[model samples]
Target: MLFNEEIQRVFKSDSWKKVNKKLIGKMLSEYMYEKMIQPNILSEEGENIEYSLQVSESKHYHYIAQKRLFDSFDVKWTTIYIVENDGRKEADSAIELLVDLQDVIGMSSETAGHLIKEMNSTLIADAHLLEKEAKRSDELIHEDYASLEGYMTGHPWITYNKGRIGFGYDDYLAFAPEQQKEIQLSWIAVHKDLASFQSVEGLDYEALIASELSEEERIRFDVKVKQHGSEPSQYYYMPVHEWQWKNTLVQNFPEELAIGRIIPLGKGEDRYLPQQSIRTFVNITNKDKHHVKLPMSILNTLVYRGLPSERTVIAPKVTEFIKGMAEKDHFLKEECRVILPGENASMNVNHPYYTQLKEAPYQYLEMLGTIWRESIYTYLEEGEQAITLAALLYEDHHHKPYVESLIDQSGLSTEEWMEQFFKVVMEPLLHYLYQYGTVFSPHGQNTIVVLKDAKPHRLAIKDFVDDVNISDQDFPELQGLSSEFKAVLRTEAPEGLTQFIFTGLFICHLRYLSNLLKNNGLMEEETFWSLLADAILNYQSRFPQLEERFKLFDFFKPELTKLCLNRNRMVDYGYSDDDDRPHASEFGKVTNALAAFQLNRTVGSN
Candidate 1:
């Protein structure tokens, strides 16, 4: 084959073994929290516990892990060993462990089979990551925002984060974010009747087109439209991922192409880099250009990385609602100075057949759409640098955390750095939940940490089309929204709304940070979580009028519902194509560490 040399280079014996061993440790740590495999406690030594999992009559796996808050575990990758009929050996294969536990965990044969493929693909990506000589965390701290995304890994919570089912090995090499390849986006013009375009009140389609495309490029594309025997005035030009055009659009929308309803315009002048989410692209040539989110029908972390048709249509409206709040409220606008990067415009072209099909698989309906979001570069001040919250969880090849490097560079102790982090991230999120009865999924990927002099300064939250949610309870603030608007945005009950912050931020992102800090001897987990409680309490003190709302959306409860990303694929939902996208599976309850800190604070005050 074509990739003989490439394969030989990336899949060397030593590199492959190391990636698999690391993956197995992650699998064990996450599986324990999800209750997928209840391994018996073999012994205990302080926080570190030795555990044995009997996979079968003749086989068992043993490892050492440290139990942390939120009912989590940190498996020591070097300590894992597997014993079979022959003898005990160091565990080196994640697939072997998955196969051994398939029956033990009650996973169906079909699910197990698909999971094996996903796990193998994840291993391949991991091996590629391992083989490359990566920049140290300290060096990466000074990198630009767009370039920094190419360094960090994927979701901290999901084990099979890069299981991109739709991609071939060639596609993975060319398009994966870590590869950091920059390419021009291919453009397509759709007949006005077949496409719908929407934008915020001030911007229209003409203005957006003018700002995005040069006068010469517009003329060149207009000529292409005329060649297809369609008037340029009757079509809306939009950018499409080259992979989507080749893999999904040409195959799915043959009828549109045949009838001259969808015409291919050549690639644009600007070269763009794909962000962590494979579908979203950032313009590298012009930093202030809008970030483009296109549909790429790949099964990655939880859902197809495709924009939902309904959400695509209403994305700009959601932006107006979210930005409107920030503009009016003095706290959000002036005091907090939180950044809301709006989805300024969107275009959706429904599949001619799937749109009419009742309960069609969701991936087909979402194959072609684009959302234009305001660039983060446009909002940055002179001294501010923006990094995704996920970057904080990254550890370099030397096992030094990026957050520690940030703290050292900031001239602040770990506790001081952490206090500022909690305050900057929590105040805006809490205000949205308690005051406006709204919440953004402040998960690592969606939340941006704005730093000044290497210290957390303010917050910027993005990806509103998919993540912004509101309260199901009737609050006067939400009364102005139309039913259509409400329908597009997910409305959750009080606890459910709170879960967006409590679980999405605390459990999904912060718990891992706390674990890293504890492991690296930076800070105690208790002090880390206690500072978070202080941030929330401090916000409450500022807004006593929202006291009842605070009670309604209580984060200080003794326990909260546990959500599992791994279990969603491994057990409950599986690989079966459903009409709707899968969600995070709720299994049990997580002990609320913040609750304990809150109680301690109240008692000490007394």
Candidate 2:
């Protein structure tokens, strides 16, 4: 009885072809009966069917109807008329009813609202499930990979706990434990010598007369007594050349000798290396009065040793060139050597390079020395060798055979090393950018990749000058650097020098990481991107500088997120849609909603 001639009109339209007309009509009837007739019929007592009719006439029903019928369609069509007729006209009218019904139901507000809500809920749940899966995957990765001790403040040496993959620094003496004992022994010996000597009791009258003897007379008497006290079998004193005695004094106690000392200057510090030494040229005036002058060579070495090998080479060369210019320009050496310490104390007595010069002269002889040591250690362990500039680039390590041997034995490929290097150094850096609004640029030769235990694992990021970005207020000393450094490190600039580093080191290296991981079957393409997105999101959540404007996860949105979500739904779940166009549209809507949520959250917090 509810089947009107208008329903026939709905069948003629193009919208009717998109869906089964019978199914649509059946669903519509079901919904109407459930809302209007069934509830009223099931009611007891004085409840009226008229009330159900009134409810059906309510504005909400019409609103839902409009939404379900019209908003649901990709292309919209309006309902024009509902006609009823008999005979041949009835069949024509039936087709017309189908056509009109097609437009109305195809763009249904109720259906659209139901589907949108259902899809959104599913996506949110999927995102949460994906997050859980990612966390589990991360745990698996950590389990497979070896862990090393991380650096800590206020420690002399870090403990590399092999089992737990934990690290900590304690109050470690700079020298080896045995070496420290040796130093203590030396100090005790000096104290014992000082203890044994006693002065003549009270200088009696006879003693005074003995003391009053002329300098030559005293020397002769002293010589005679020394001769009498000598052993009978052998003379105690041996003849020495006058030149030898004079030369000994001159060489050992020269007017300008390089003074160096190994001491623990800072007290109560843990993990302090005794290798750090203070060295300077001391001008000995009358043995007591001396002037301490710092040297450029020593300063350069100190700074160099503190950096990675790659950076050490570059920094020293630049520093040496600057020093040469300064010397030519008659610049005061003191000005060049000045260093600002934490306190207001100006330390002019010690050379700026004293730390390196006194502690590890051999270590700072050249940049190649450090690289050689690292490579040799890897080679002995039978790990993946490092491809140094020597073999691949056809250049020897400063033309040194020993250095070349170290590189050859290491057996690490440059590509592998670079891959590891980016992971260790560049990953943390991008994370820093997300959190702190800045990072150090580790471009050029400042980057180093090292292989360990047959797997490329270590990445050394160097060059703090062009790399580190601290707020101007926090690090006023940085103001002395060039304006380029300042601008690149600024928070406001997009695609600044800092971003260049991110794009170069992090984004570009992603492909390499993917290849390596995929080759080993460690991760698939979808998993790789998901992992990357998770890393970025985690970094942003932790750092969150200018979070409203900065969206690190956005980079992976349309590609990675869609792929993961759509793939999972299509492959695992049976979502059979003929066009497949709805999937993309669904993703777009979801992205829009997410963006809106982010914006709203930002606004609400403010």
| Model 2 C-alpha lDDT per residue in residues 173-285, reported as the tens digit of each score | 11111112111101000111111111122423234224323355444534543444422122111111122123221232232122211111111111111111111111111
TM-score quality measure for candidate 1:
0.99
Residue 29 of candidate 1: its Cα lDDT?
93
- Residue 4 displacement in candidate 2 (angstroms): 98
Candidate that scores best on TM-score: 1
Residue 376 in model 1: lDDT: 97
- Model 1 worst lDDT run, 10 consecutive residues: 125-134
RMSD of 2: 33.6
